[model samples]
Target: MSTTIAPDRPARTGEAVPRATAGAVLGALMRQRLRRDRWQILIWLLCIALLAMFSASAIDQTYGDANARAQLIRLAIADPTIIVLRGLPQGTSLAAVAFFEIYTFLALLAGLMNTFLAVRHSRAEEESGRAELVGSTPAGRLLPTTATVLHAVAVNAALAVVTALGFIAAGLPAYGSFVAGAATAGAGFAFFAVGLLLAQLMNTSRGANGFAAAVVVLAYLVRGIGDAMGTPFGDGTHQRSAWPTWLSPIGWGEQFAPYTGDDWRPLLLQLGLAVLLIAAVFGLQAVRDSGAGLIPERAGRATARPALGGVFGLAWRLQWPTVLGWTIGGALGGLLAGALGTVINSSIADNPALSGIRDAIGRIGGGGSGPLTQLFISAIFSIIGVLAAACAVQTVIRLRQEEASGTAELVMSAPVTRTRWLFSYVAVGVIAVLAVLLAGAIASGLSAVAAGEGASTFGDSFAAAAAQVPVALVYLGVLTLVFVLVPSWTAPVGWAALGLGAFVGIFGGLVKLPEGVRHLSPFADAPVVVGDVDWTGGYWMLGITVVALAGAAALIRRRDFAIG
Candidate 1:
């Protein structure tokens, strides 16, 4: 027999093997990541940049006079609620005011973007068994992580440049725009390291993502609290953050003080933290087994519970922890709404100039009453609606995950109809939406009463919560339909839609977006519970939800189970 040698194979198996260089491997991996994430990255970058540009222009238009900007600053300094919701007041300069109005939000988005990037490349790949496959090649384990880090750095660099250009395009000082960009990129890199380390620790991609996202949110809230507690100085338009702000990456971003102080030292703090975390990640990667996390998955029950007996029960079991987390977040928003609404109302009573702030909030929340308390409740609950909508979106995404992981095939192997399987998850989504809204309503009502409000506040709380229900249902139903029609686009499309809807619905009024465009957001159509209350929007949303859900049911039966 004649032996044929393959050109791509080694001349002899027992002889030395020719492996690719580490630099070549790293470049290949980074190129793969960029190609995979190009569209996602583009969307994120565009949204963030538009936010900066629009916010700068909005501030310029609304607070044209320095006196007006100063008054706005003084009001924010006095109202802890505003400070907690906005950002630390730097100064009354047009540039400073723009940075103060928008930087925190920018940093929050950047952090989320980076963390998701990290988790997706690390734990998610490992979970899909791709990491092990890569490990068996010249790329190996540590080199892949190194590539991820490099990819993150390059992405953040692009993010920084675009962000700076966005502000500069809005006619802010060029130098200060660059500084703001640095702040955003710095915070993002820090969060990226946090996600990388968590990926090394958590047993599953879902667990890592949930934990990382929670950490990002917690950092933002902590920074907000510190800013709200800050002491005003420098003509009462500048305030230094309290000590608690130092504890968060988002807080570190704020300390950059772009357009006012323009401090660059804070970048060092962010870089240092990233270095430490990245070092720890590399250490863990070297020591731990491939395709396994440092933390072990808990052993499952030897016998399944009664709740595992049916599809709906199994769906709830898998999803309740996520639902509970969102419910708690809604409850917290309610708690803040009730407690802070009273304090702000009293402040507004003493300072009539603050009524503009109240009015703007009312408009963002749709038509509402004149009382500052009522307007504040409307605004906060509008946010809670976003939370409930997010829960609904995630539920639909979970169904896609099950199908992609090949688990749906196993489930379908049992005596279960596809429509029934679809309905089971849909039912759980409905329950989760209701649970979040109900928790918020109850918490808001109790806190309002505790704050010495009248019994009627309960009516207001439930009404606001009820108005949000239709909005949440619309998101659930429509996104479920999307999932059924385009299973692969489910996660990306769902999150992007949510993010766009939230920005348009919550900040559209602030930016003076066109009325027709604003009305497209479900949040803008939420029912107003106050004087001459209109339930028309809610009724319309309910109709849409029903139609969408029915369509999803019809379509879900037509698709094959996906395993990707």
Candidate 2:
């Protein structure tokens, strides 16, 4: 009893031990992430490839003839909006010019994917406590960061390869095809590096994501402004200026010009900047503690107020920031649309080629004239509103999150009925959605009025924008039903539902998809104002909302709370 057992000791070395190389660490991390999330990654990549191929084939068929190409070029030069939205490349080849027009948007989407993935791997893991376990092993400090970068590199590589193959298969020149693909991948990599730097600086995942997204929005704005200024309409002829485009990363990528000038120097600058960003990440890692960031997290309130006693109040408090953000964002988007609409109406009168572009927008907007164009713009704005409503639904499901974390049990034990608690959050979501839609309507209306449009014009635009709310509510109801029935899988299901709706709403008309599939999107039934207001679709949308909400409520009543 007096004798003490000797404790087992870790192995000690007299000489310095060689750690794993950065590349080895990076490779292992990339493989692990790929193995864990292969399905999601594969699906995302496949979607991108399919869309690119579809776009390439469509352009080939649409503008294959010499006369068609000439018409398109002439029309593009005449409309400032067309040129800003889709750049005019100096190429006679239909495929090359099409690549130039679409590459900017594609590259932006690719960048978003890379940035989000990188942040999820590097920062989100640490926030969730998974990184601590990984770090406790023989892993070096730089290993996780290296792995994130390597994974991003692999994704970019795959994107580039797939895009290049799609273009080549679509019968484009090999050199130009490869150049376009590489430019997109290069831009994505640059943003991936930028995201890492943001992740290192911010404590919360939301903050990091918001910062990165803001940067992307800024890049797009810079490109738009530059393009607009460079080709201002004076005497019905197009002129190009270089200064504005020089300041934008997107513009830098575009300067490669796909098939036109085929410039390759700009890509080297992108790569160099990425390298500098990586070095900065390493320096940040050396200075900061594990599981923490350069920016300190604010100290939350030590005590909860009586108003925070219920689920609805708590939901509002948690979701208010995101709701405000989307509301502000949607309002700004509406204002921009109004401004653009005025420009289009004014500019189209003087230009003949520009006339065809309006016809195209009208067709997509369900084929009407003046008022219908405004309705089409309103529909686009409504999509943004739908997204905001989806965010609200997700916030309401944070109730489940709270329950799983053991906080809900304590609150429930303090004498609260489940129905009242659930409805509270639902009520808050309803209010938030209405507030956001109203904000958007007001902003768009003000913009229209400022542009010398009639007050009645504002009323019509506001009505069209608000009409999509019922469709959005139906989506929210469906998501809520999923949460009640299968809580564990609700997040993915909800996100997939939103993604499917977006695909159908945006691309169904563009591609020759089946009518049944397109009809499944709630947005497909949304009212579009061609010449006059269409109230028929509004009734159908309202009916769908009622059915979805009733189904969700019924499901919730039947199901027991799935919590510990």
Best by lDDT: 1
TM-scores for every predicted model = 0.93, 0.82
Clashing pairs in 1: none
Expressed as tens digits, the lDDT of each residue in 1-564 for candidate 1 is 994333453222122224546676788899999987887888888888988887898888888899988988887887787787678999999989988888888888898889889998999889888888777666667778889999999999999999999999999999999999999999999999999999999988778878888998899899999998889887899999999899988899889888877899999999999999999998888878776888888999999999898999999998999999999999998898788778888877788877777766676678667577777888889989999999999899889888987888889999999999998999999999999988988899899899988887778888889989999999999998988887877877777777768777776776566678678789888888866689999999999999998998898888887777
Q: For candidate 2, which ten residues in a row score worst on lDDT?
A: 9-18
Write candidate 2's Cα lDDT for 3-32 as tens digits: 433224311212121454334545667789
lDDT (Cα) of model 2: 0.66
Colliding residue pairs in candidate 2: 372-530
lDDT, model 2, position 161: 83
Off by over 4 Å in 2: 1-28, 87-92, 232-242, 364-366, 372-376, 379-432, 478-504, 507-524, 535-564
Candidate 1 lowest-lDDT run of ten: 9-18
Predicted structure with the largest TM-score when compared to the true one: 1
lDDT of 1: 0.86
Candidate 1 regions exceeding 4 Å error are: 1-20
CA lDDT of each candidate? Answer: 0.86, 0.66
